[model samples]
Target: MHGTSPPESQRNLSRGLILLLATACGAMVANLYYAQTLIDTIGPEIGLSPGVAGAITTLTQLGYGAGLALFVPLGDLFENKRLALLSTAGAILGCLGIAASNGPVSFLAASLITGICATGAQVVLPLASHLAVKERQGRVIGTIMSGLLFGIMLARPVASFLADAISWRAVFLLSAGLMAAIGIALWFVCPTRKPETKLGYGAILGSVWGQLRRHRALRLRAFYQAMLFAAFNLFWTAAPLELLRNFDFTQQQVAWFALAGAGGALAAPLAGSLADRGLMWWTSFGALLMLTLSFIGADVAVAATSVAAFVIAAILIDTGVQLNQITGQKIIFALSSDARARVNAAYMTVMFVVGASGSLIGSATFEHGGWTLSALTGAAIGGIALVIFLLFDRGASDPD
Candidate 1:
C-alpha cells in the first residue's frame, strides 16, 4: 500500500523473518526489565533510600509509556527498518550510560533512556502484524508475542544470575553489546516498510485521540489490558522482595523462581490460536479468573512458606497475563489496516502508564504490610478488571 513493491505473496513473512522479529522483540524489551531484580544491589551501591530505589522500576516504566506516546507512532511516519534501527542504537547508548553511572541520579537517567529506546519492540510488533496476511495474523502475532513475553519473564532471572556471578554493572554492559549486535542484524535482514499515511507528525499525534474516540472495541480492550498489566507488574515487582524477606532466598534462588515463571510463555501461542477461532471472550474471561485465583494462591503460599505453591502461582499469573495480552492485540490489530501503529501506540501508552503505577503501589504495599497486602491488592485489581470485562465487554464482536 505504501508504494510499488513486492506483491503480497512475495512479501509473506518467511520463517527466518519471523524468528528475527521474535528475537528482536525479546532483545529490545529485555532492556526495560533488567534492573528490576538488581535494585537491591544497586540501591546500596548508590546510596539510594528504599523509597527512591523503588522508583527505579517506576521510572523505567514511565519512560516506556512516554516512548509509546512520542516514538512508537513513528513506525507509521517513517520506514520501519530505519525507525527500529534508530531506536536500537539509542538503547545501546542508554545501556552504556547505565553501565558507566557512578551515582543514583545518573543511573536513573540512563534507565529512563533505556526504557524509552526499548519501544523498538513495540515497533517490531506492528510491523509483523502489517506483514502477515489477514487470516494468519493471529498466529503470526502470537508467535512474535511469545518471544516478547519470554523476554519479559526471563529478564529477571538472567539479570539476577549475571549480577550474582559478576556485578550489576556487567549486566548493563552485556545488554549494550547485545543491543548493538541485534541492531546490526536487523539492518541487514529486516524488510523495509514505508507506511502509506501522508499525515505530518503533528497530525499523526493529533489523530491518536480521534482514533480512540472512534473505536469502542479499542477502548474496551485497552482498558482490560491495562488492568491485566498492572496486576502482572504488581506480582513480579513484589515477588522478589517476598522471597528475600520471608524465605531468605539468595539472588540465585530468585533467578530460579523467575525461570519457572517462563513456563507462561506457552500461553501466548495458545491464546492466539483461540482468538483465531473466535474464542477471545471466553479465553479472556478465563484468563482474568485465573489471574484472581493466582494471587490468592500466592497469598496462601507466602503464609505457609511453600515454595511449590509459590511456583504454581507464578506460572498461573504469567499465563493469565500473556493470554489476555495476545488476545487483546489480535482484536486491536484488526480494527484498521492503515492505522495499526497509531492504534497500538495509544493502547500501549495507556497500559504501560497504569502498569508503572502498579509497580509503585506494589513496592509501597510490600514495604508496609508485607506480601499478603501486595497479593490481595493484585487480586482486587484482577477482580475489578473481570467485572468490567463481563459487564461491558461480553458483547464485543470478533475482528472481521
Candidate 2:
C-alpha cells in the first residue's frame, strides 16, 4: 500500500503484453548493434580510416551510456507508456539519420543518437519487473531479457546478411521502419504506469547517486555484470575482424558464426530459475568461470585457426555473460521496489560505460596485437571480476 500500485487486474502481466514487450525490446535494442558488423563495409564507402571505422561501435555504445544516464531515470518521473513511446520515436529519427548520412562525421553522429534513443529497451525492462509479482519477477525479467539478448546476438548476422544482399545503408532504413511500427503498436498496447513520487526531475535524477550509495548489493552486482559485459563486448567487437581477416570469411559466413553465438541466449531463463531457487552465488561463480575459460579457449582457437573451437568458445562466452547479467538483475531489482527504475539506471549506466570502453579497448588491442591480445585482455578482465566476486560480494544473496 505504500508504493505505487495499479488496480489488481492491471498488475497481472498478460501473455499479450509480455510478448509485446519482448518484441519491442528486441527491435529497439537492435538499433545500437547493427553498425558493428558493417564497420568494414561502411568505412571504405564513407572514406574513414580503419581506426575511425572501429570507433563507430565505441561511439554508439557511448551514446547508449549517455541515454541510460539521462533518460532512463525519467521512468521514475513519468507515465511509462508515454516514456517508452517517446523514446521509440526518437530511435526512429536516429535510424533515419544514420541511413541518410553520406559521410563519416554525419554517420558517427547519427550512430550516437541511435544509441541514445535505444535506452527504450532499458525502460521496458524495469517496467516489466514492476508489473510482475514478487515471486515471478525473475522469470518475467528473464523472459524479456531473452528477447534482448537475442537481439544483441542476432543483430550482427542479420545486418551482415542484409548488407550483403542490399547495401549497408539499407539496414538502418529497414530498422527505422521496424521501429516505427513497433512504436505505434506499443503506444496502443502498453498499460499506463504512473509513479507515485512527488520528486522533481532534478531531485529524481539526483537520487540515483544516493541509491547507489545506499545499496551495497547494487554496487557489487552492477560491477559483476559490468565486467562480464565488457568481456562480452570485447569478444563480439573483435570477432568479426578476426573471422574476416584470419579465416577469410565472407560477410555471410561471419553471419553464420554470429548465429551460432545466439545459442547463449538460452542461459537467461535457466539463470532466472536458479536465482528463484536461491542459487545465485553458485550461478554467479559458474558464469564467471565459464567466461574466463571461454576467452582462454578462444585465444587458443584463434591461434590454431580452428573454426569449431571459435564457435564453441562463442557459445560458452555468451552463455556465461547472459547468466551473470540475469542473476545480477534479479538481485538488484529486489533492492528497492519504489526506486527500481533509478536503481536499474545506476546499475546499467555503470555497466554500459565500462562496456563502451571494452569496445574501444578490444578494437585497439586487435589493431595492434591481433585476436590473441584481445582474447587475453577479455580473459584477464573476467578473471579480475571473479576475484572481486569471491572477495567482496559477501552480502549478495537472493531475497527471501
Each candidate structure's TM-score, on Cα atoms with residue i matched to residue i, is 0.93, 0.93
What is candidate 2's CA lDDT for residue 341?
84
lDDT minimum window of 10 residues, candidate 2: 1-10
Count of steric clashes across candidates, in order:
0, 0
Candidate 1 residue 320 Cα shift, in angstroms, is 0.7
TM-score of 1: 0.93
Model 2 Cα lDDT, one tens digit per residue, 1-400: 2245666666789878887888788888898889877888899888789977877877787788888888998988888888899989989988899888888899889888888888999999988888887667777787788889998888988998898899988999999898888888887878788888889989998998888899999988888888988899899879888999989998789899999989999888888888877788999999999999999999999889899999999999999988888888999888887787899999998888777677778889999999999999999999999999999988675565
Candidate 1's C-alpha lDDT?
0.87
Report the Cα RMSD per candidate: 2.2, 2.3
TM-score of candidate 2 versus the correct structure, residues matched by position: 0.93
Q: After best superposition, candidate 1 residue 347: deviation in angstroms?
A: 0.6
- Error (Å) of candidate 2 at residue 152 is 1.4
